[model samples]
Target: MGCLSATRSKAIHKIDIPALDWPMARFPRYKYPLEDYVHENQQEDAKCLEETEDLIHKYNAAGKPVAAILVEPIQAEGGDNHASPEFFQGLQQIGKRTGAALLIDEVQTGGGPTGKMWCHEHFDLPEAPDIVTFSKKMLTGGYYFKEEFKPPQGYRIYNTWMGDPSKVIMLEEVIRVIQRDRLLENVNESGDILMKGLTTLQNQYPQHINSTRGRGTFIAFDGTNAAKRDSIVNKLKLQGIHSGGCGDKSVRLRPALIFQPHHANIFLNKLETVLSNL
Candidate 1:
């Protein structure tokens, strides 16, 4: 029901769909090296949080109560925008005080890519999210929630495209392999390598790329502008790595959980080669 309404981006202007009249709140933008800009980031988070609460209250007063607070742990499609864990904590409290369910869209940050089964786990929320939606790397699509959220009516949500049970069955085995092989550990190891190597690259090529950020292998860095970002993506593909671009002018990295130290080293070397010529 909310599919058409989910898109809340500047490019939403380009889409000619009849979206619902849901109130939209701004997602916070933070400076990279989150440590260096802690004060500014905290202020940004506070401003967004206040606006979100005001929107919720205004809509409620207008008799259109906010039901669920949906968010991505890291704004993957929104160019990998990230907020501090404290920001999430604030949102969760807002949800609790307002009886709004916290619905985390984990399609881009799930299945152990963030060194956890779900990215929200990093926030240490008081309780599990009211609902957790997942897809993509999980090999199927569905959402899970605490028992309290069970639908009040039967057949409230049903669809033929709920996805194949076989995919879920296969995914069960995939989970086993991930656990048996300790892939989360591998992700952490590779993530360290990526952060270290990317930091070095950022230092060396500040003009071409900057603000390298991400968790685990789900990383990204910005180019000077959209044109340079596209060129970087194209150059990376030419070098035999199928890289992708996201947001306005950012190159994103969404490597598999099985990516290892050697894989990180290879990506770094190839990326360095790309930056060197740029």
Candidate 2:
């Protein structure tokens, strides 16, 4: 699996658990306000892609062939980090050249958070990934795969229930609601307002926060420190606006797709109140 995060410098999750000695490559750390960081971010992309290729080669030469490479469109659990489309495109090419099946994990950023059905769709990959694992917003856990990845024989990927059929029924209703309410459009509209508010807040509180980033309504910002981050979350909750933190000092926004512009304003207003108190 390909692991990406700046917070690795802090600690690795579940290090006590036994894990395969797989090759881990660093993903890019792009400067925020992506448009302004184009040149630098491109360089960052090249660097990470090169490191990935080198690691794959090194492992293969040592007779530890990597069967697949796993990545997240937006490394959600790893601090809501993001990489560029060009970066993802290059990684796909490298995976193809190296004969490693490309797997995109959309556990958090899928189901319209990034203004698309799937975050990987934003990359404009030449073809679908070999595997696409999803859950969270999907209201279930499963994966889609290219036909070639299908098991040649039955029972290869079976489980007691495989997945709950009841969940499927619930998902059907969820899909209906998404379509009936045009939630994707709502996601886009609310995301615009939320991001603008975040940018303004970031500017106003530069000493306490920075690195405001995300697509659609999936947003996050880094606090000055871990304590400050936790305090912000706690304060927001006490004010009746719940939020979450990831990495060491990042607050993530995970509003539902149906969340409207007015709801975005309420969140921002709560955030402003919290910042003032902080």
Candidate 3:
């Protein structure tokens, strides 16, 4: 059996769980605004890539070869952390060299929120990942995989209660709706409004906010600290906006594909009110 391993990225929810004795490499903590910190972010990427390769090698030499490396295209629960396309491409190459299957977890970023069915599509990987997992908006939890990952025996993938097949029926209708309504296009349109509004808010309230980042409508911004973040979320909730916080002090925006430009405007106005009061 291969040794289990994981990345040391800030997937906040993992903090309370008992983890396996696996080697973990740091995820790049890029500085923002991304344009101004290009060179530094590049160096950060290089450093993380090096550490990942080192850990893979270290584990292999220890006789527990890593069989796979799993990652989120955008680290959603991890403060909406993002890595450049170059970073993802590099990671793919490293995984290939190390004989590790690259597994992308698209549970949060999938189903058109990032204006793509799969968030990793934006990375422009040379080829598809060896495995892709999805659930959330997908209507049912499942995965896709390259032939090599398939087990030779039947029942190997069984669970006590197979997920409802009825969900698949709903999933099919959901796909039809997305395509017929051009919801992906709506995602891009709404995303632009939200991103721009967040940027404006950050500029107007730099003391309270910073590090606004995301793609399509899958966005997030960090507060100066956790208390401020919670306060902002609470205020927004009172105003009828149901948003949430993640990764310690970041506020995340996970809107439905049906969310449109006008909806974004309402959200922006409410957000502005909350920030101004703060």
What overall lDDT goes with each candidate model? 0.88, 0.86, 0.88
lDDT of 1 at 250: 93
Clashing pairs in 3: none
Candidate whose TM-score is highest: 1
Greater TM-score among 1 and 2 belongs to 1
lDDT per residue for candidate 1 within 23-131, as digits (tens), equals 8888899998788999999999999999999999999899999999999999988898988888899999999888789999998898999888889988988888999
Runs off by more than 4 Å, candidate 2:
1-16
Model 3, position 274, has a per-residue lDDT of: 93
lDDT of 2 by residue, 139-178 (tens): 8888889999988999998888878788889988988988
The TM-score values for the models, in the order shown, are 0.94, 0.92, 0.92
RMSD of each: 1.9, 2.9, 2.8
lDDT of 3 by residue, 129-244 (tens): 99998998998878889998889999988876665778888999999999999999999999999999999999999988899998899999999999999999999999999998
Worst 10-residue lDDT window for candidate 2 reads 1-10
Off by over 4 Å in 3: 1-19, 159-164
